[model samples]
Target: MRYIISYVSTVNPNISNSDMTALMDYVRLNNNAIGLMGILIYSEGNFFQILEGEEQTVKMMFEKIRKDYRHHNIIKMLDKEIISSSFSESRSSFTVISDHYNQSELHQFLKKEEEHNPEHYKSISYLAQKFMKFN
Candidate 1:
């Protein structure tokens, strides 16, 4: 089984970029032990990312995030049991470009997707397009 979780945490005002980089290095090195698929950290309007493997791996990674001096208040915005991961291909971990944040649209689409796939975890990307723009 797989899970998808999107979370946010407050960055510690005192932490520096170099410290963050070192912390991320530890996370990258110990990923497999924790069941991480991918991690994306948002700071100063920029999102940093790491992708690992497994549910336990991801959970362990999140635990480290909670204790990191760089982050303060942590909150998980999304979590779900996934039938399959969108990231099975590619390296065990990688970080790169991130897309723009379109919050209202994303939330609205997720709501509708949950409604449509109440029993199964189905993709609602197209349905979101059909309904969200009209409303």
Candidate 2:
């Protein structure tokens, strides 16, 4: 069965750009190796991420994220048994969305995609936007 989990977290304020890049690279490599498809977005000191794959795989990844020291205040926003991942269309199964992104655009894009799928999960990209507004 496929499963997806979305979460929001505060980036460690002291982390440097190079550090973040290293973190993303490490995560992307691991996720792709395990056939996970997802997006990790960092905006203005916060992170919004979604991960999807086999149920056990997704859960294991989330556990690793929870223990990761790069971020804090981890909050699981959305979790569901899904039919498929919204990110499966990407050539790279795992991607890092940072450097530049439009919050409203991202929200609308995810919302629109969700409309075409089973309504088993709620969209949390809005919360991603809301979190980015803080700092």
Top candidate on lDDT is 2
* Quality of model 1 by C-alpha lDDT: 0.50
In model 2, what is the error at residue 109, expressed in angstroms? 7.7
Models 1 onward score TM values of 0.54, 0.72
Our model 1 lands, by Cα RMSD against the true structure, at 8.3
Candidate 2 accuracy as lDDT: 0.73
Q: Quote the positional error of residue 19 for candidate 2 in Å.
A: 0.8
Instruction: List, residue by residue over 1-135, the lDDT tens digit for candidate 1.
Output: 676665655557676767656655665566534546554544353333433355665566667666866666666655566675544433344332112234454454346436644542243344323323434
> lDDT of each prediction vs. the true structure?
0.50, 0.73
Model 1 spans with C-alpha error above 4 angstroms: 32-35, 45-52, 96-135
- Give the distance in Å from residue 63's predicted Cα in candidate 2 to where it truly belongs: 0.7
